[model samples]
Target: MSSAVVGLLIQELPKGGMMMTRTLILGIAATIVAAPSGAFADTPAGNQQAQNTSDAREIVCRRMPPPAGTRIGPRNICRTQAEWDLLQQQNREEVERQQDASHYSRGN
Candidate 1:
């Protein structure tokens, strides 16, 4: 409620009714504070779109081994599922290339 409306309500209260005025103001304030929370409760389209986007970009976290010869603990790595898949593919390709190069070097 606007301050003007609240002021009018205060003026209209019966003389010496401090308790009633306090209760009315508290009720109005509570309504104002709680009203917005329910405003989005029934918005299905917006909520569904947000849910879908969150599902698609959901994060995956892993504990990666520390670098060779280091005394540090394993570190945490975070990425989306798609990014993890791409990284695994690249690592496999690099291993294959190294194997091929080593084979050629041995003339086998």
Candidate 2:
């Protein structure tokens, strides 16, 4: 509960000045509650943050999803294992082509 600060001019402030006072107090109270605490619990070093393996693994993790997200039926293109296999095969072939191009570009 926030107590109000009544100002120097009480009557001249206007009608319902007490309500305005309480509103200002409540706003300040909410601000204090929402603020981040000054003290932080143990955090990794700044450079080490970018080096975390979890971020690296996400690129691979995103390739596949839960089995339920597949199998809405035959109408859905990637709903079956065959479709996923084909997708992976295409991606592998494209990667190989890129690598072969790079190998020739380097005169290897």
Clashing pairs for predicted structure model 2, backbone only: none
> For model 2, how does the per-residue alpha-carbon lDDT over 71-102 read when each residue is reduced to its tens digit?
63433232344445567899999999998888
Q: List the candidate 2 regions with Cα displacement exceeding 4 Å.
A: 1-15, 38-108
TM-score on alpha carbons, each prediction: 0.43, 0.28
Which of the numbered candidates is closest to the native, going by highest lDDT? 1
User: Model-by-model lDDT, in order?
Assistant: 0.83, 0.56
Q: Tell me which residue pairs clash in candidate 1.
A: none
Instruction: Give the winner by TM-score.
Output: 1
Q: Taking the tens digit of each residue's C-alpha lDDT, what string does model 1 give over 1-108?
A: 776777777777778977878687979877997899988687578888888667658899999999999999999999987688789999999999998888765454
For model 1, give the 10-residue run with minimal summed lDDT. 99-108
Q: Over all chains combined, what TM-score does candidate 1 have?
A: 0.43
Listed per model in order, the count of residue pairs whose N, CA or C atoms clash below 3 Å is: 0, 0
Model 2, 9: alpha-carbon shift in Å? 14
